[model samples]
Target chain A: MSLPEDYLRYPLRRRGMDQDRYEWRPRADAPRRAWPNGAKVAACIVAPLEFHMLNPSGKPFKHPGAMQTPYPDLRHYTTRDYGVRVGAFRLLDALKRHRVRITFAVNAVLLTRAAPLIEAITADGHEIAAYGWDTDTLHWGGLVETEEAARVDKVRAAFAAAGLAPRAWLSPARSQSFATPDIVRAAGFDICLDWEMDNTPVAMRTAAGLLHCVPLSNELDDRKLLIDQRQTEEEWRAQILEANALLQSEHDRFGGQTLAFTLTPYVIGQPFRIWALDALLSALATDDAVWTATASELVEACA
Target chain B: MHADPNLYDYWPYRDRPRIAWPGGKKLAFWVAPNIEFYEFDPPANPSRPGWPRPAPDVVGYSQRDWGNRIGHWRLMELLDKYAIRGSISLSTALIDHHPEIIEACVARRWEFFSHGIYNTRYSYGMSEAQERAMIEDSIASVEKATGQRIRGYLAPALTHTERTFDLIAALDFWYTCDLFQDDQPQPLKTKSGKVVSMPYSLEVNDVITYGAMAMSPWRYADVLKRHFDQLLQEGERSGVVMCIPLHAYLVSQAHRIRPFEEALRHIASHADDVWFATAVEIAGFYREHCWDQTIADIDRRGLARPGVGFAP
Candidate 1:
């Protein structure tokens, strides 16, 4: 069980950014911050408007619910299309009914395909946050910094063409390299929501300037809860209630906290599960302590 | 590389074979406690590196060693309380280094399976002869220590060479926890004898859920509950396998251990609906009753070649 000293000199495998990007500050140690209108808790709902390639190379299908049978999986393809066609509207109507504002993390390519949906989202006064160019293109597996910068520029141009100014960025599938935070900051996004390391929003120093890292719940996400974990509707509802209660208690002790609830139309857009979202929103709406805001609003308040 | 289609015949999940476990249970549940011993420094594999940090990785080694010293005992107590027998995935080297830990597991009558000689040692670039020798060592060590022949193989840290499956089958192992393509026990195409791939989950594994996903202990419990709930509902149509893989270092931390206990307790409460069995028991039952029929069903669907084995 002994080894050579040469192994020690091998290149260190770095995955994400080094710790120098942000200082170590516990959530409890941070200064007390309050949400707008003296709200106890700030809640943000993120809806990812994504487009999966019909025939992704290597893997036959894109996701679990995608068709598993033959090539040209029309079943899964159209099922994804159902998000823009029907699910997005259902979510929009629910948000309207509950009087909650949401942020649609839209892929730049989705704007070309579903411009009307983008218009509808804007008309309803919801925020548009840039997700990526598309689901197929990613920044993780050896994607160089130059190419990533180009992709970011393209995404910004797409948002501008759509008459929207997106100040936030959430990578597709939360995939990024060590240079992602710097690249994201250089691309002019004021906030990045991919990092889930902390419960409270922390500031990171990128090459360009300061970038706010808004934390999202990796466990309570709709895709993980409903599809990957196969949680029943009852369990999904319970998780929301339980998470809200815990965050409220944390607020009572430390200070105000943010709860970012992520929903994807393809997963939570089903007729049966849509009610859970409705129920969660309705419950949150009844609570006077909950301040449902978009990601930008929360980041602005913290800034 | 993508898996060879011939290795596992395509069986669309919708209307496939109906597998019934003992007592009409919908799902067969098992817990695999990977009691391992990681060396402070080990020979390097040409394919992959050993540690993320520098050599003499005291932090990495001691973190895993803490599992044997303290975490394993706490976990074992919880398993005993739930009446769940662990299929101990042993690092064969532990038989020499930590006989006391092996003795405790043996006293509990838990089943033993080979993970590898050492958690630090890997099978990435081993020649066929080297791999065969390692397998033989596993067989001899486990039988000498626990008095039970090894029935399963999970590659050390889930690493494998090209010929891992064929070698395991050639050695007459009944099941493997490597192939994670399906929820049910599916037939694997090997060189010599038949081998069924058990549905051991990387999704629910404590290491992946807590360490990799960065979820809190309570969140980890919530995930386990949700995973079990969905699998139970689906099990009504076809019997499924639910595996909760544990590494004492991750789940048995003082703060994390209670949630792990609570999750197991919640699962154990559904005793009537699920079959609490070892990996060997599930593989044995499937081999005796449902293996042939499952293969036949795959053949009837025209998904695989009849006589040819997997070439990959």
Candidate 2:
């Protein structure tokens, strides 16, 4: 829904903080003094990388029915040889080939299992972050099964085992617990990358505090356009170009904002998919206004 | 048919604050009960403003047309196609009439949650004991049909007596969705001091907001994608829960199924960032991890403190 005209007439308000007349902040760290005369965008390779023997192919395990033997393959495979290293390396190679900085929202389990790739992504200057460990997407009120304190302990244990400190987290499947922000901030993240208001950064305040957010536009995710069988690739590409063009325009209209595209390794990390991505990036990059950066870097720039 | 006045009031003061968890992400997933069309006695006048006028060739004992069956099957197809599972909040009459629907749900092992005997059968005027009997009877009927225990109850339009929770818990059901609090599941101490709320959402409920909102299939998908993006972004800093509630009947419709396909496909592809789970699984997770003294403490504070706050 379009924001009600009165929506702006009265500034958006949340408790504990008075609403401000919306003001756009110029970034001291933005590479350009003013976003070039066109729409500007920042791209982050946001991959929810999964690793585990149970979820080797990132599919849920199911009990085998009557005729089935001891176990059945309840898992789904995206590509052959479904190991974290093989898939992740392919992903790393693609991002590196594109010279894109990715924010690996590592499922803690996957990060631990795929240490080599985690280190490789880290070594490649891409950011390594948290995508909750065992709880698939959101806790759904089920984490440790008892106390919130125990739940905190489980998250800590998973992160500690990974040997990497993450300041930002992405919910599994975009799922969140109300307690997530407080828990994440308590865990020490300064920004959240989960908002989809517009293709610009907006500030979200929670009980923890004000966490800067990079709003994601749904138009960019390939799953919506291609995988869901809703649109053909040609149509999808046109939509992509159209959306990017619009964001570039919006950025030009509203200065100093960052636009981000969150891509999945399973979708864009493939060979043919890489081409579509390349075509889109090539087109956007030609515009001097748009620049691609890792999500963490954008977070740092905005916060 | 007048809308409940309670639906419009914003308990803004009750809006949850960002509780700070210093160690790890707090993730929550909600499994919502979407019961589309269970057999209901046709609208008394049959010419009601909000409902569809009955078709000319309507058949059988109920005099109901299965024009909506195509949509229901489509919903089934999509859920099966994606391997997405959920709790089917069912009306008893729907289960009694369409045993295959229950069979389909059971085949997928969808969580069986009660949604009264029919869409029209609210527990509104029922005595407390009657409400309890409905609770007991619903559980027995659903468990027998689905071959799985029915552990949760979502009142018709969230209608029920104050003792609903206690009766639900007393009936040995695991959770109830009569309340929408923080995205996490927490105990709600009634005056009777029993029964708790496992969070569910009207915010995320799709039938009224998306389906009846006349949102296009693309926009419906976009709505979910947008919410996913928001939750994931928010989770990056401090984790949070995102819930998408569906109704088998509404989303199963020809126009609405595409969004379901789009949403599940989008979410599944990002499997690493999301956990696709059933409501029961989520409830189990919350009980284990997020629910505790903090929640009980919040409940004990007796409405003064509002939503849970992390130990700042």
Candidate 3:
């Protein structure tokens, strides 16, 4: 039997990242702008402080950073929790030594569970950006708009109670639905770090206002580099240096380019891998061309 | 019909039959260079369009055409430099349009496998007779051009009918590279004869890595190195297979080729550990020795069943 013509239409083409809402604007067309203190490159280090629930719902749908295998995967679960227990501290100390203030994309659940750690981060003069309620509760995987809104509200309430009003939102697993931007805007987020489509920041048209998508590097993430790709620590260091060099060359032409180093504490916080982070932070700190700033600071400068 | 749920007999990686290559090597590495012919405007299969944009897509056509005209040579030279023999996944129409490319590959003693008549002409909506004709055409045309009977099948752009595996097996093809489920070679259930599914990666393929993932050439090199490193480690126990699928248009660009060569260099540097064998060689080796035991193990585990139509 011949396959029906409608077979193609059933699994509808994946129309990723609405072009109407976020149109492609060339880097050269971007306005001539300078980062804070006239630095050429804005290096935003996003450290995700997360918690993978002991038991996930096993919803048949999974994304990167989601729990794989089965329930009570203690080896995987404890390894993920290691980010909060030991990795986050190593990262924090490394950043402190380099005098770099990072943006910690905190899961709201960690606000209560690891309150002291969150408090220590804020006290260090770093920015706290929302990274969903928990790692398991994602906005893209069949999450309704109302529930998504509630998740945002819960995150905001936690931040507000701690005298923090996070202006940025980085979704866990970088998952997003059609209503995500509008919902994010309604929830009072100014910048989003989920979209990895471009190198430069692009303005996304939303109902509330223009939401700035501060482009994150999908290639340079620790989870992708270490866990998924299984690169050596030396290769990870080389990737960072090569990426920065390329971006630096591009920045020379375009001017307002941001380099976001996305890090998951669990992945990069290990004793061997943590040194790569130290090397990267130390290298970036010394580079005068790179203006190391939090995600909020970079957003404000671009604004 | 869809793919057979029981197409591949399951045996756990831990307890599977041990596969040994020609040189007692741990991993069987093969590079599949897809030498394709994408027409400027072709007859469409209703299931999918020929191009992303409306046809007479000059830019799209010329870019792929560039692979045949220029990129293929550069890539061939690089592959030759590393003493790597590519298993050319030929879109058979290239034999008519660009016989010189086919001649060049034949001269190098590279293996030829069927990738359909044209890359644009998919097998999505083909009738049983049409699909059979396409397969027969692949066997006839490839044999006529290169004096080599096609031993393997990688469906056009990986589009296949439920009967694809069964058809290939009936036609005496040794292996199919369309299955992406396993790391090791395994027998595919067919009505006629045994056809093993060889490991061909979409993960490490240049088209997916560069075009779909939008990764840089240097990053691609890093990924390839890491992939090879991990597979080599895994191969120390039971043997592993690594297929690096390449498209000339993507990987043979001026800047990209050198980094790609760097990846090949890294892989080649581990010459002692890896057996750089073609898909046919790997399948032949497995069939001669491990085939019966592997199938028996899977049968004992109650995995060797008839089709259930869950085509990959």
Counting clashing residue pairs in each candidate, in order, gives: 0, 60, 3
- lDDT string for model 1 (A106-130, tens) is 9898786677678778889999999
Q: Please give the TM-score of chain B in predicted model 1.
A: 0.96
Among all candidates shown, the one with the greatest TM-score: 1
| Candidate 3 Cα deviation (angstroms), residue A70 | 29
Query: Which residue window of length 10 is worst by lDDT in model 1 chain A?
Result: A58-67
Model 3 in CAPRI terms: which quality? incorrect
Error of 3 at A177 (Å): 16
Ranking 1 against 2 by DockQ, winner = 1
DockQ of 3: 0.03
Q: Whole-model Cα lDDT per candidate? A: 0.79, 0.54, 0.79
- Which runs of model 2 end up more than 4 angstroms from their true locations? A1-303, B1-26, B30-33, B36-68, B191-196, B236-239, B296-312
Superior candidate under TM-score, 1 versus 3: 1
Q: Return the clash pairs for model 3, or none.
A: B3-B309, B3-B310, B3-B311
Q: Ranking under DockQ, best-scoring first?
A: 1, 3, 2
Which candidate leads in DockQ? Answer: 1
Please write out the lDDT profile of model 2 over residues B259-283, one tens digit for every residue.
6688768766765555566667666
Q: Write the per-residue lDDT of candidate 3 for residues A31-89, one digit (tens) a residue.
A: 76688666778888898888776456635345465554322233244446556754676
Interface RMSD of each candidate, angstroms, one decimal: 12.2, 22.4, 15.2
lDDT of 1 by residue, B1-312 (tens): 322224555453445578889999999999999999887878887655677776788888889989989999999999999889999888999999999999998899899999989988878768889988998899999999888999899988776665777898988999998765566888787878778888786657887677655678987887787678767866888898999999999899999998777888888999999999999999999999899888788666424554333363
**Positional deviation of residue A88's Cα in model 1 after best superposition, in angstroms:** 20
